[model samples]
Target: MERPNNVPLPGVSAARAAERATSLAAHLDARHRGQNAQALIRAAVKDLFRGRIALVSSFGADSAVLLHLVAQVDPTTPVIFVDTGQLFEETLQYRDQLVALLGLTDVRSVGPKTDRLARLDPENFLWQSNPDLCCRIRKVEPLAEAIGDFPAWISGRKRFQNAFRAELPVFEGDGARIKVNPLAEWTGKDVEAYRLEHGLPEHPLVKFGYLSIGCAPCTDRVKPGEDPRAGRWRGRAKTECGIHIAGSMTPENEGSGI
Candidate 1:
């Protein structure tokens, strides 16, 4: 029997993937090493990938700093926001407010296809029984489809947020696309100081201890002394939604906010 047609296949071979990753990693190390986040984003938005790139943001607790920097670099840079249909209403409103406040002109809101959701999660309780599947259906598939046209995309993950991201690089390639992590070297204090310096508005739930807000069903409040991302998928070992996972790689701990 032939393979199912609806499934997505890996686009690059193992040999090609390793070669591309090595080449890109070397280039990024030389050019972006020790560079600040704003400069890195500027290069990604205007110099390197330019029109072929988009910034992926959750507009969660740690979002304002990155969004503000991107706006300053180019408000017209494509900003892709994924709405899982399970997000808090406050997140939707916050997205609106930030778009206007930052003068971001090209923000695109994408989500799961209706038919897929109806077929797979009609009851809307998939997270209770299967959170990984729920994340893939809601987040991974949608984000993958949303950015398929781009050669490079930006992510907002930071090293300080979790153990899985401790050694993240400024540029990562899985042979298919270049993933930029401008804030890989940033710490919690750096983010907070920048947020306060720019007077960026915090997500409403941040005050309620929801440090890393995502779809309301899978997110929870972080207790004091926990990592900022501790509130996300509290009971599960799964951290990523598969959007950031390369072929055969362990799932990335994308944190609650990314």
Candidate 2:
């Protein structure tokens, strides 16, 4: 019998899956490092993962550049957007604007389960008391569920975003799946240049200095001289939203938030 398209290889133990992701990440990183972003995305979407991969976009700040590149390569590629219930209204509108402008197909907007929210956070104050748990329910868990069937996924993280991401690789192993960062080598200037060169629309909030937009409650405007992601979860030690953390697919192991 033949395996179904886009489904993970069957019966592979978790350990085996992890090993495969590691090997694949190393291979892809070596082969595509320093290449153009479009070429990397093209290969991932059209040649390598093909039907088994998806793009996870936040549609904030410099997202339009990556979305435009992916649309150029293949507009029908699956795009996953985690609509944390607390996101800025501007972010949602920007998502819609970019989707229509880029002609993206298959944009999946996954959110935290309503039943889980009612049970764990009836008052929706989890972010004030336990941000890690809030992110687990709102961002990581939903994304994990959204990408459950994909063997690989793309992210828009770049090295210049912050110190924590200064050494981001072009590819990485996220538990059993391969995570590709086509823009890992791009700088803030590079992103802006691409957006201008391609005439992509900017995220509406960028003009107001919300360099790293996330959920409304946590995101803030950046100062004149700060890391692009500094405004995210301001005054908190949390640097990530737990979605990018290894083993984050499991709620119990959810790390920090971005």
lDDT of 1 by residue, 19-42 (tens): 665576567757779999999998
Return the top candidate by lDDT: 2
lDDT of 2 at 60: 86
Top model number, TM-score = 2
Off by over 4 Å in 2: 1-11, 250-258
Across 1-258, the per-residue lDDT of candidate 2 in tens digits comes to 222132336676666667777777887799788788888988888888888889999888888988898899999999999998999999999999999988998999999988888987899999999998898889887888888768789999999899898889998987778899999988899999989998888888899989999999999999998999999889999999987877775323433233
Give the per-residue Cα lDDT of candidate 1 at 183.
92
Q: Would you list the clashing residue pairs of candidate 1?
A: none
lDDT, each prediction:
0.80, 0.85
Candidate 1 lowest-lDDT run of ten: 248-257
